[model samples]
Target: MDGYVMRLNQFISHNAKYSRREADILIEQGRVNIEKTKANTKSVLLEGQRVFIDGKYVKPKDEELYTVIVYHKPKGELVSKKDDRGRRVVYDTLGGKYMHFVPIGRLDFASEGVLLLTDNKKVAQSLMESDLEREYIIKINGKITEEMIRAMNEGIHIENASTGAHQKSKIYSMTFAPFIRYEIGKNDIHFSKLKVTIMEGKNRELRRFFAHFKADVMDLRRIRYGWINLNALPVGKIRFLNKDEYKQLHQFMGKIGKIDSFISKNNI
Candidate 1:
């Protein structure tokens, strides 16, 4: 029970599919159940419980060797498991079989950035749960004020509510305060091109932040996340983590558990 586990509802949220409340509605309609019991909407899930949703057996995804891929997703590509409209997908560019992985976090279809895709559910869950930092290179038209920085760093009240109850739209982790670190000279005027960092991976949070200030995001890109950086990966291209980089990621997670030991012993 010490390892990765989540309630039936939380499992849905973690999958990036739907919210917990929505999961509950599915449960109430007898669409989901834990073991053989009708799911208690608020019941806590212990490790190693067999679950089912809509007659499909639920299992935490498992793939070979905790693979992590850094995808330089270009704009207009969807980050979904499958695109209904048959538009270009990130996986389509990956080519061949990749063991059906899921993205660790998301970037809007219109935004371009570094996105993490992996088949290791635990690794994905830990990255979302841990206090690891994320860095972004944001380009916006107009000036950024001190108060705006303060609000971005301290957390912004997203114009609309999110899946969770926290009114302080968790677009950022407490580890980072929003600040503009750089400004490039454009036609003798100091324009804003800021490098910001945070941990929370809220959907469309970047666009929402600038929206609150009436500023338009000319371009937004996630350059780094925790120990990994998308230094030279070309847009729409991806590469798997070498053994050393994979080990380094485990170390950066603060020596959490036997995942490190397992990786070391197996050389994965």
Candidate 2:
């Protein structure tokens, strides 16, 4: 029964859209099976054992086959499945079709825009970990300072980027890369509006960046991620990547050594 052995949760996670953590919850709830018997938390799988979740048999899928959805997330919604504080989450608005999709990177509860969610774990993980540019339209409470422009152009290292961060954030320090580019919309003593592009997605990065200058990020919205744009997508709606978008993604992935890394990670 054992050419190679694996944990029940790992099997379900690799075979389905659920994460390893979500797979564990499914097993604990008695929703998974191995070799036609209900599985528990400690259940293990042999190389050839069959697995079923919710009455459907599943197996490892390595075809590079998957789907991506671009969602125009709205502010005030958490990126989580459910919130501990009972706040609305993206899933509540994302609806049933994308119940298990993994978000590429988070936009935080207060920010919104071209959020990418995919059914493929590898795609989601790869994109999130990549250094692709993220473009944003943001408004800060104070005028754009010359010092800020210098910092953006030359990049800056902060010992403790302390303010404007989420209360629960444990990130005390960060090194920000020079912005790819920036364009000012309006700047005055009242507030400054600008569009900036950068390739880092550290925790509450925009907020923290402005905070370092004693400015508050008044309104922050992401306009683009890599080659995908928010375009005319209304808030709280989702769309599939068009043919051109998929082609761009595929080409990018191919050059990014995606195939070899994915093969090695899955031990295929």
Candidate 3:
């Protein structure tokens, strides 16, 4: 307990072994240990303690660099590490260079655009929790009307499947619809394109929100996340965040001086 004592799940995740949720699973399965004793999800590790996962030693990762990359994720690739059906994932397409990088948030398999990958779990967690904005370029199968936009902005109630009684099932509902700042683009009679920005990142939220309006999203691409934008970077390629980009990202996360400390510690 000399330097930094971190929670077991955080330590496991920070080592680039697994996500915090996955670490909890490993701990609950009795696969994690410290000093030959079974570890719990809430267990804390001292500065110099060694951790073993599945009887294999877990090495500490160098957190000094805190590398972040902006990846132009093309459609058809999952943001997950491995897929049950063996479909191509972002890692599969990235090869071995970013094996330890974790996606900040996710873009569904069918959606494409700017994706942030990082080795630092704290930074990733911070960004996910922050009120950072994301911009998307979407194409829907029908003309968007002012009423639809107003309803979306005012919020809509959607059925909550998770909250229902057995048998006769008294189903409940939840209000969704984040404020959508949008600009419509001229398109063919069958479809219309929109550039929309939202602050929250709910699971398939944009698609579900549009579905409420009876507007099917034919194409969806996220062009921006926080201060990071998918400028001219070619799809399927990744580039490290430049100095300004890193600074701006940290600023958005309210983590000023973090980049400087990382650079100084790693001498990068």
Compare the candidates by TM-score and give the number of the best one: 2
The residue-by-residue lDDT of candidate 3 on 1-268, one tens digit each, is 5666799887887785576888899999999999788899779988788999988888887654588999999999999877788899998888766867888998988889999988887688778866788999999887887766776578667785222112333534546655658787855569989898888755677776676667777888889898888999999988989899887765655553566578899999
Cα deviation of 25, candidate 2, in Å: 3.6
Highest lDDT: give the candidate number: 2
lDDT by residue (tens digit), candidate 2, 1-268: 5476678776776567666788889888888888778898788887678898887888666647888899999999999877778999998898766766878999888888989998777788779988899999999998999989998899888889868778887878888888999999999999999999999766988788888998899889998999999999999989999999999988877866766788899999
Candidate 2, pairs of clashing residues = none
If scored against the real structure, what TM-score would every candidate get? 0.62, 0.88, 0.75
Runs in model 3 deviating more than 4 A are 1-10, 17-44, 52-59, 62-64, 160-174, 177-180, 253-268
Residue 29 lDDT in candidate 3: 96
Give a tens-digit lDDT track for model 1, residues 218-261: 78888887778889988888888878788897675556566678
- Cα lDDT for residue 93, model 1? 81
Candidate 3 root-mean-square deviation in Å:
6.9
* Predicted structure 3, TM vs. truth: 0.75
Q: What is the lDDT of residue 207 in candidate 1?
A: 63
Q: What is the C-alpha lDDT of each candidate?
A: 0.68, 0.85, 0.79
